[model samples]
Target: MEQEKDTKSNGDDVSRLEKYKEELIAIHHKSQETFEQQLSYISAGSLALSIGFVKDIVKDIDCAGYRPLLGIGWVLMVITLLLNLVSHLLAVKFYRKSISEIHRNEFVSSKSDTRFDKITWLNWTCVGTLVLGILLIIIFVNHNL
Candidate 1:
């Protein structure tokens, strides 16, 4: 009777452990999916905003002649900004998700480590795009005046 009781307890523990693992996996997958959805939404929004901003820049000018490059500059800037936003949203989302799952998942650390590249690259892209945009606007305005 004593042996039977021990065996039953051990089996219960094994079953519980497996259940916990399965739960953790499900949680991790759900968390990852949420992040991915947000990433897609953000990417789409950024692209739309960039396109609109560029369209505004090149729409019309008071200058005697149309500045061809004004439009192009805005275009480049907008594209860069959108790309940077994409990188940033994805990187940050992935990092946060990984941190949240660190306790249950060993792979979180590896995923977190890879986000640095996205961060740095995104930073540069945003900076370059903004500068280009400002320069282009100035050029267009000066020429129009």
Candidate 2:
């Protein structure tokens, strides 16, 4: 009777392990997609920043009254870039963690992928800052003109 009970428990464990493997594969694909999406955001943000900077410099608008505003705008943009970088790094970190959990046979489907929520907030903050910076730059340039 004890042997029968042991065999049944082993079968259950094997079935559970198989389910975990299937779930882990899906989680891996999702994590890869998330990482790729984050990289895209970083790349796009870089291009926008570069173009905006070039345009601003080409205009060569110099006004003493708006100098402070221009300075603040530049600072905000720099911060935005830094935050984007941090968010990108966070994506990598989450991917590594997910992989590690899977290897340890401790992966839980419910707890696997939501770590990127913080990255979403960070991305939004980056966008907000970039927009504010552009607005300030526009206001300063227009005022000077």
Candidate 3:
């Protein structure tokens, strides 16, 4: 009976480990997908703002004396774009590291465990920056109008 209980306990541990690994993989995939979407949207918006709206923005600023506000808004949007890119890149880096660790059956260190948290922090920072950027742009446009 003692031997049997030990074997059963070992089996349960293996089962739990497998489940944990699956959860980690799922979270990693979701993070990657979310970051990609953010990066793409920001990249396209920034490009459009720069290329399609520059002449109009300049004309509006010349007429309205909101040059400083427009400049600040544009700068904020650039910062948002950069933050998203950095977050996406770092997520990819840490995701690969996680997969490599799993494949090697290596023990996870405390530092390695914090990678996910770091990723989350980066994502939130990107989002907050994006919101601030949009607010600046809105203020600029309203002023220009």
lDDT scores for all predictions? 0.62, 0.72, 0.71
The worst-scoring run of ten residues by lDDT in candidate 1 lies at: 57-66
Count backbone overlaps in model 3. Answer: 0
Pairs in clash, predicted candidate 2: none
* Order of candidate numbers by TM-score, starting with the best: 3, 2, 1
| Higher-scoring candidate on TM-score, 2 or 3 | 3
Runs in model 2 lying further than 4 Å from the true structure? 1-63
Residue range 1-145, candidate 3, lDDT tens digits: 9999999999999999999999998997886787758665874585467435556654544575555665666666677677667877887788789779889988487768798788778777767766676676666666655
* TM-scores of all candidate predictions against the true structure: 0.47, 0.58, 0.67
Q: Write the per-residue lDDT of candidate 1 for residues 9-42, one digit (tens) a residue.
A: 9999999999999999799668645644554454
Candidate 3, residue 66: CA error in Å? 3.0
Q: After superposition, how far is residue 69 of candidate 2 from its true place, in Å?
A: 1.5
Error of 2 at 109 (Å): 4.1
What is residue 42's positional error in candidate 1, in angstroms? 18
Alpha-carbon RMSD, each predicted model = 9.9, 7.4, 3.9
Query: Which whole-number lDDT from 0 to 100 does residue 46 have in model 1?
Result: 46
Q: Residues 1-145, candidate 2, lDDT per residue (tens digit)?
A: 9999999999999999999999997997687567546645654564466446546753554433476667777777778778877887897888788889999998876676568778778878877877787677667656664
